[model samples]
Target: MRNPLSDKVISIEPSGIRKFFDIVSEMKDAISLGVGEPDFDTPWHIRDEGIYSLEKGRTFYTSNAGLKELKVEICKYLKRRVGLDYDYNLETLVTVGGSEAIDLALRAMINPGDEVLIPQPSYVSYLPCTVLADGVPVVIELKAENQFKLTRQELLDGITPKTKILILPFPNNPTGAIMTREELKEIVEVVIEKDIFVITDEIYSELSYSGNHVSIAEFPGMKERTILINGFSKAYAMTGWRLGYAVGPKEIIEQMIKIHQFAIMCAPTTSQYAAVEALKNGDEDVAAMREAYDQRRRFLVNAFKEMKLECFEPFGAFYVFPCIREFGMTSDEFATRLLKEEKVAVVPGTAFGSCGEGFLRISYAYSLENLKLALERINRFVERLRAEKCN
Candidate 1:
């Protein structure tokens, strides 16, 4: 018998984030701040739309590119909310989720051995998708001194002759760092000169604090070079519905659509109907969630500060990455100790990148009550560690 496995499949480790989630599942009394998902249920109105679709017997496939009205509404929402103007016909491709959009965009454009520039301490999918797409992932680490924002210098440093794509995941995950318009302008200058393609994952755009979210599409000469990925999941608490969309240059989007068509014919029929409702009627729900999340974000930051654990205040996503070096433990060790001793679940920052070694990421997506309890548990854990140090 042959020991058969694809060489590409052999090189990657299983997802680090999944390991902790699985562990927490078996442990009773675990309070998990590890998962990246929103705690809110899918809003009643949105759920009702899907249920209504089924009763109407509209249970067939949508157009492979997705419903025309949904794509039109996506264009309108982007313009109204985020200042990104996209063409519904020529520039957009509806995907199964932002995950599949990432995969399809990479598959459509990546030639083998081409380098894909990704900022570290980002969502985990980008690296693995780059590898699976037969593209080389060159990670540029985002730094604490920079508030985990990727600098233009860092962007330039990662580029070489073979570099083909740059993924911009602002209003970022894990670190919660967001880039400003001036910062994005600095990056756009280099990217335009190099003629490099960009994949901008703006799924968390609505959840931003301090300012309205800006899009790379707003930059001069960038709409042609940028692929914009946003979805129903993060913004509308619709993760389980599995709907996302991408918009970019027609040539690129058309190629992605080809890949999407062959692999998956259409997004879910009910999800398409529900997503249309979300884009239409769900803005209020999003605003309410963002308001609640901002409070949790404030609470989590103060908890870290009270413990004397150094942390940069996060601006966008519902996570805080706090330095754990004071504990004199590796990120994994700190995480393991927290889970075992206090029954609290937080992700090791190293799960995001090599540079995340001295940190831990805690999600603020839970309710105020659960967050209060988690913080109390964290306080008790930290006090015990201090007493142990004194002894």
Candidate 2:
């Protein structure tokens, strides 16, 4: 038989986060703090809107870009929240999820041999999406000393004549690092000087525990060259709804919409209607959930501190990336041992990138009760590890 698989596809490994999550799912009495999913149900009013949409038979495919009303609402939400303005009709393309927007933006923007600068300890999809788009993935290792925020020097070092797109995964996953407005201004200068576009994934925008989430696109001269990707998943707790959107220059957005048009047709119609409701009337629900996540975030930070674990206080997202190097084990080895010995599951930081070695990403998206129970196990595990080292 002839060979059928693409070498490129075969070369890609599966997600390391899912590897542990699947194992924990099968293990009895195991608790997983690995996945970044929120514990909240989709807000009640949003669910009601979806049900109402179905009852009204609003089941047809929306325009490839999305429903006009939803697009307008997304624009309003962005402007109101982030101080960025975009034309709903000309600059926005609704996608199946923020994941799809990441993929679509890469496919639309990259040509073969183009280089994409990806900051490490970010969401897993960026590097692979660049590869699938036939672009070279240049990894920029973010320093823990800098709280994992990409710096101007680091961005400048990553750029080359071939560098075209920079994937800015701020309010970052796994690391929970966020760039302030001042920090972003430094990056903005480098990007403008280097003439590189950016795909800024801000899916966790509202989950930011620091001040308001700042997008690189919020900087002057950025909106035109930046594809801002966000969705209802992190903030609105609508992960399963499979809804997200991208906003950028009309030229770039038109290209993304073309890919989305043929591949996805449109985002789910009912989810679109529900998201409209979410944008219009779900602020209070989001605020309540944000408050809960903030409490859990603080609890995890304090728990790690009390355990004598070396962890930087992360200011965004519901994860804590604590250093596990003192245990004298690689991140994978430590995570594996913890799961096997204590039935407590967390992701190895290396899953995000090699730069994440010696760290583990523990999500606090679960309830306080679950977090407390898991922390007890984690503390016990750390005590045991320290005793072993002394021996």
Candidate 3:
């Protein structure tokens, strides 16, 4: 009998993050700081809108691009927040989630053997999605000294004649690193000069702890060449709602919508209505949640500092990538031992990419109480390791 699975799919490994999440689920008293999800409940008004949509029997499929109202709101939110303008009718597409938008963008643009520049220690999906899309995945290893921000030289180094796209994952996932406008200007120059397109995933835009988040699309000559992807999941605590959107040159978005149409038909109608509420009036809720996340972020940074651990301060998203090379263990080994001995679970940084070795990604999305308890366990584990090294 012939093998049923596609060889391409078989070559890809499953998500490394999921393994620890599954293990911690069944372990008694285990605490996980691995998942990058908000702890806040969806704001009441947003939930109310979804409920109201259902009560009004608005369950029918929306247009393939999504509800016109939601798309317009997304454009408005982008213009108001990031100063980037997009045409709602032709340039925007609502997706099942930001992950789907990522996949859609890759599939829409990639041709076989086209090179895609992917910065390492990024969200795991970008690399594999490029592979599945038949794009060559060129990894750009971001440096710890540079705070993991992709530099102009790094971008240039990754580009070649066949380079077609650059996946810009700012307010990055595992590192929580954000690219400021100054930093982004350098990258924008490289992208324009190289004549390569960009897929900038700004899903964590509102979670920025430093200054306001900046979008590469805001720069001159960039909007035409950039696909901007964002969603309500991180900012509005609407992860389970399964809604996200993309905005780009209409030509690219048209292709993405075509894929979304055949594959998903439409994003959830109720979620669309709720997201409208989120964009229109959920600013205060986002601000409150962001403030809470900022607090937790600071607490984690300081905890690592007091433990004498080496961790760079991350100014965006809700995670900290702390170096664990002092322990002389690979990220996987250290994380495994911590889980086995202390019942504290954190994702090995290698889950993001190979360059993430000797580091761990610890999310700060949990409550203060849980973070405090988990930190205590981690501190104990670290102290024990230090003592053994001295002996």
lDDT of 1 by residue, 107-183 (tens): 99999999999998898899999999999999999899999998989998999999999999999988999999999
- Which regions of candidate 1 fall more than 4 Å away from where they truly are? none
- The alpha-carbon deviation from the true structure for residue 351 of candidate 3, after best TM-score superposition, in angstroms, is 0.2
True lDDT of residue 163, candidate 2: 97
> Model 2 residue 321 lDDT?
97
Best candidate, lDDT-wise?
Answer: 3
| lDDT, model 3 | 0.95
Runs with alpha carbons beyond 4 Å of true place in candidate 2: none
TM-score, per-candidate, Cα-based: 0.98, 0.99, 0.99
Candidate 3 Cα misplacement greater than 4 A, ranges: none
**lDDT scores for all predictions?**
0.91, 0.93, 0.95
List model 2 lDDT by residue over 158-275, tens digit each.
8999999999998989888998999999999999988999999999889888788888898889888999999999889999999999999999999999999889899999999999
Tell me the tens digit of each residue's lDDT in model 3 across 1-391: 9999899999898999999999999999999999988989998999999999999999999999999999999999998998887899999999999999999999999999999999999999998899999989999999999999999999998889999999999999999999999999999989998899999999999999888999999999999999999998999999999999999999999999999989999999999999999999999999999999999999999999999999999999999999999999999999999999999999999999999999999999999999999999999999999999999
Clashes of 2: 0
Alpha carbon deviation, residue 250, candidate 3 (Å)? 0.5
Q: What is the C-alpha RMSD of each candidate to the true structure, in Å?
A: 1.1, 0.7, 0.6
